[model samples]
Target: MNASDRTPADLLRSALAADPARPLVTFYDDATGERVELSVATFANWVAKTANLLQGDLAAAPGDRLALLLPAHWQSAVWLLAASSVGVTVEVGGDPADADLVVSGPDTLEAARACSGERVALALRPLGGRFPQPPAGFADYAVEVPGQGDRFAPYAPVDPDAPALAVGGLELTGVQLVGRARADAAELGLAPGSRLLSGRAYDSWDGLSAGLFAPLVAGGSVVLCRNLGELSQEGLDKRVESERVTNTAV
Candidate 1:
């Protein structure tokens, strides 16, 4: 298929086949002094496992809306791709009450409990650890995802024209999402193999585009930083130098 006809999942698959050993995402939590890097193969493995969990265990379907109540962490990125792989619509920071499934971070547990659908809670801890115990009304993602198959196949083929993402009162189909991401990557001067360091939060289009989708569309990699306020100008510069960052979106 041509690039314009490809979905985000297709982009990921291409990246996996083209350069499995290259870093696709490098995440940093400045507040907690944590850093994690995932190669294309590693990230795709996580996506596969999570996709299996969503499709098999959670019974997710193409039109189902998955409320993603998480921040700009690497795991959140994984969930985005997993939902795309199964043609499940991702509602970032959306109201859980209307969702078919809810995936929440530690801080949003109370709000997520209001959703009646299946719930998954993420610790967002270092190494993507599980909660010490399962939350009252939710399954622990880290625990369940590990037992899932390392490879995933959707029950049915994903439609590129299907609604895929909803954020900031805007929704886009899978094809539209990929098209916009490709344009944004070009506008931002992201070439293949570029390393982008981004400190934008994922709640808005600019952040999501810069920190995740653009890099994926451009065949580049992202160094997504959370709690960026904790970094001084010097520290930030040092990170850019150390990480070989070719672009910055702060």
Candidate 2:
């Protein structure tokens, strides 16, 4: 991570300053045969729009709790950074009823309705498509997010020392989260411009670090694969080669 970076949003800004045109995330869903790549600028644009949706539409404030009930897809990555930018605490796979707001994927929409607060749903379709019918009691993320502003400025500044993530029974401040991400990036042998291929779920700290934060802090990109077990060795090898992956955390 950059020495000047405090929050995850700061890290993203540092990366954007470094190279906005370079690919920051390459996502593939073996089960659906889908592939998508986003440069730093493109990824940050999505983050900005999503952050606007969270802060403006959902009326989320700093310290608000967000239950993220999504998988390790590109949209999930967008939501993570967006929540961080909004200064909202994110709880991965958290209980809906305990959250001030819940963001869920198609598979978890029914369960996400337990949240009495605001709810957002992602269809997880290719190219970030919307659901045919909006789920009841939940805003369609793909639909609402696009209409949001391209740029975002948090009404309230995020506190680096404030809680930013709650996962695996552990709570971490933004500073601590960045510290851990830097450490994980080192342990995973990531370097500037490195591409790390990860085929892990986003339910645990390890998976989260590998799939998202580590690469972010390392000034590298991620090849995030979902349902990777379904891919043949030949296919996986081809993907690794095509994505120019230098490290693996599958």
Candidate 3:
């Protein structure tokens, strides 16, 4: 782990500095037969735009709580990093009523309305499509995100000691989050440039580390798979070979 990396966003910047063209997150939805590969540059661009939207359009400030009501998809990963970039505390599957802002998927829009603050909804379609009819009372993330600035600069610097994540009944500061991710990476034997295929949900700390942060801090990549259980053993083996996966967390 890079000793200079004090936050998750720092980890991403270090990855970008290492090799912008390297594949960072490759997402697959077995149920929909969808696959999308994002290089470090591409993923960081998305993170920047989303971060701008979160801070500028949504009026989010450091220490603000955001309820992220999305599944373990690639876009969810993008939102995770975006929130971290701006120092927003992400609550995985958190209660909407208590959040200062909320991001929801199509499946959780109804529940996310409980948030009295700003709300954004994601269609979660292939290529990040928008809702056929934009949901009422919530901005379409795909629609709004495209117009945001490509470069993000948070108005206030992030505090590493401040709370950054809350999930699985555990709350961690930025320092704690990155530190744990590094530990998990070592425990999972992930090496630099390793490709990890993760089939874990994002509702717990284990899933967050394995699916996103661990590989990231390890200078590796993630093949995030949804509904992977539906794949046959042979199919899964073929995928492992095709993606050159070195580790797995399911």
Candidate 4:
């Protein structure tokens, strides 16, 4: 099979084997004013745990919709990894109404459900939001959710053309998104161990699949910016000059 034919599981298995401990994903945490680095192995484990929780605990059915309204933190990465672990397709958006389950920040929960999540709860929130500045009523995900499952179960490989994510009527399925990611990685020359300076937003058109998932599933490091303004002309120049970022799909 061609690179485009590689499944998310295929890509993930490769990344974990190559350098599971290597910094695969980074997030700028607004609450702590710091960068949170998640190693691929640990992230993979979390993904497994999350997939199990969603499947066994939450009783999430295959092909059922999940909404991730998580803050732009490391947990957002967890949601992505977990969703991929299961064959469950996720509909990440500001709206929870479109989703059967919703995971969001303490403050964002109400809006998350109103938009698409059915009966919003705290299970889908980031761990950081719990401690110092927990949103009013929500409990810590660890505290509220209590247990985290061990491993992810096997599911049939999703159809390439099955609808994976949607915006209005526009939809991209698992196989379709992975195909595009591989194409982006190749067309952009994303090599293993390459660092990407991404100034885009996950909610934006390009950032979601291309800036983030494409490089990641391709085995590249992504330096995410919480704000585009932070990647100022000077900052961009410095990152490119100093970090030697091979590509900027932002």
RMSD of 1: 1.1
**Model 3 TM-score, all chains together:** 0.99
Candidates, ranked, lDDT: 3, 2, 1, 4
Q: lDDT tens string, model 3, 1-250?
A: 4789988999999999999999999999999999999999999999999999999989999999999999899999999999999999999999999999999999999999999999999999999999999999999998999998889898999998999999988999999999999999999999899999999999999998988999999999999999998899999999999999999998
| Per-candidate local distance difference test | 0.93, 0.93, 0.95, 0.62
User: What is the TM-score ranking, best to worst?
Assistant: 3, 2, 1, 4
Q: Report the C-alpha lDDT of model 4 over 109-142, residue by residue, as the tens digit.
A: 6676354323333433244334454444333455
For each candidate, what TM-score against the reference?
A: 0.98, 0.99, 0.99, 0.79
Error of 2 at 56 (Å): 0.5
Give lDDT: candidate 4, residue 152: 61
In candidate 3, position 80 carries an lDDT of 90
Most lDDT-accurate candidate: 3
Task: Kindly indicate the candidate among 3 and 4 with the higher lDDT.
Answer: 3
Model 2 clash pairs are none
TM-score of 4: 0.79
Candidate 2 lDDT over 1-250, as tens digits, reads 4798988899899999999999998999989999999999999999999999999999999999999999999999999999999999999999999999999999988889899999999999999999999998989988898899999999988999999999889899999999999999999999999999999999988999999999999999999999999999998899888788899999
Candidate 4 global CA lDDT score: 0.62
